[model samples]
Target: MAKEQHKTNAMRTLDATGARYEARFFDCPEALSGVEVARRLGIDEDRVFKTLVTEGRSGAHYVFMIPVACELDLKKAAAAAGEKAVAMVRSRDLLPLTGYVHGGCSPIGMKRLFPTAIDETCDLHERIAFSGGRIGCQIEMAPDDLARVIPLSRADLIVL
Candidate 1:
């Protein structure tokens, strides 16, 4: 049997919203891409989402959720966020800005709420997984349930 993982801030927030989710942990000796993580978890890469932080031209912060197998289309992302342009937040700035590290960022809980968007493709899956606020930890739940836990919009944020 797998050991129960401790609750993370993200998990606590999800619980507060009464959203159901499964928290899991996987061995992560090296920082791995979301795709690799999903592969190791024996799940479809499309069902595993990665949380990304980006800064708009106006200096406003934004968050995006996309499948591990796809890349965020900066142009499409900016359009979805109603920004003139946007760029990924520097790795070092992730923790200070969102209170999450590079490999463990979660769209669910951040230091402050930012405008967030998830790839519309998420709707294709009944359940999706994302980092559980820590590297090596993951949380799986319905996309709609995740939306209820946090204000999020679904859009074409991924590169086709």
Candidate 2:
């Protein structure tokens, strides 16, 4: 007998779009930082991204993806989203707003498709990895393929 794999909403969404992706799973019982995840997966931190949700001054929600080793510059992010300012949504509000718990949020399959931006640095990579809509899983795919699944703009979003 073999164990059946559990498909997350993110994985299902990718399947529906016919996007090419690789689902990688590791032993993670609780939430961990992106860098930690990369370390556990024996992957380069630069190729791993972390999803962040923020609320703009206009009350609009936005998503940003940046390399695990970098930090999101709020000012740059706001500029990318065309907002006066943006602040990270509280962890308690993540589930209700994005249908994903902290540390498990993926840019795809959110409760709603919010404005999304990926750091321009992502373009430098042939492929990138992000949360697979769960704490213990990851999804790796080409940047262009991800853009085909979700409408996103590339911007300089990381701190200098």
Candidate 3:
């Protein structure tokens, strides 16, 4: 028998949006960073993205996706988001704000649809991977497809 796959909220959202993706699962009972996740999954770090939740000066929340190995450039992100300044939300507020835990936040299914931006580097790959709204699962799909599922725009959000 094949191992059963857990369908996360992220996956379900993708299905509802008719987005195409391949789910990837790994053993992770504890929270792990995006780079660690890519290493464990044996995928290139550049092709793995991490979801970050930030609050702008106006107190509105925003989401940004960047490559696992890179950091989000606050200045660039703020500029792209048209916010005077932005800072990451506390980890404790993650679940309540996004309906996702620290390591399992996916850009696809958030509690509310916040303005989202993805690093322009994602365009270099035909497909990229992101958390599947769960700690041990991930979803791989074309960047264009992801934009269809989420109201996202791509920009130079990553730090040089």
Winner by lDDT: 2
In model 3, which residue pairs have backbone atoms overlapping below 3 Å?
A: none
Candidate 1 to native Cα RMSD, angstroms: 1.8
Clashes of each: 0, 0, 0
lDDT of 2 by residue, 1-160 (tens): 1123668889999988999999899998899989999999998999999999999999999999999999999999999999999999999999999999999999999999999999999989999999989899899999999999999899999999
**Prediction RMSDs, each to the true structure:** 1.8, 2.1, 1.9
Best by TM-score: 2
Model 1 quality (TM-score): 0.95
Each model's lDDT: 0.91, 0.94, 0.90
lDDT (Cα, tens digit) per residue for candidate 3, span 4-69:
368878888888888889998889989898999999999999999999999999999999999998
Ten consecutive residues with minimal summed lDDT in candidate 2?
A: 1-10
Per-residue lDDT, model 1, residue 20, is 88
Which pairs of residues collide in model 1?
A: none
Off by over 4 Å in 2: 1-4
- lDDT score, residue 156, model 2? 97
> If ranked by TM-score, best first, what sequence of candidates would result?
2, 3, 1
Give per-residue CA lDDT, model 1, range 1-160, as digits (tens): 1233577889888877888899889888656999889988899999999999999999999999999989999999999999999999999999999999989999877999999999999999999999998999899999999988889999998877
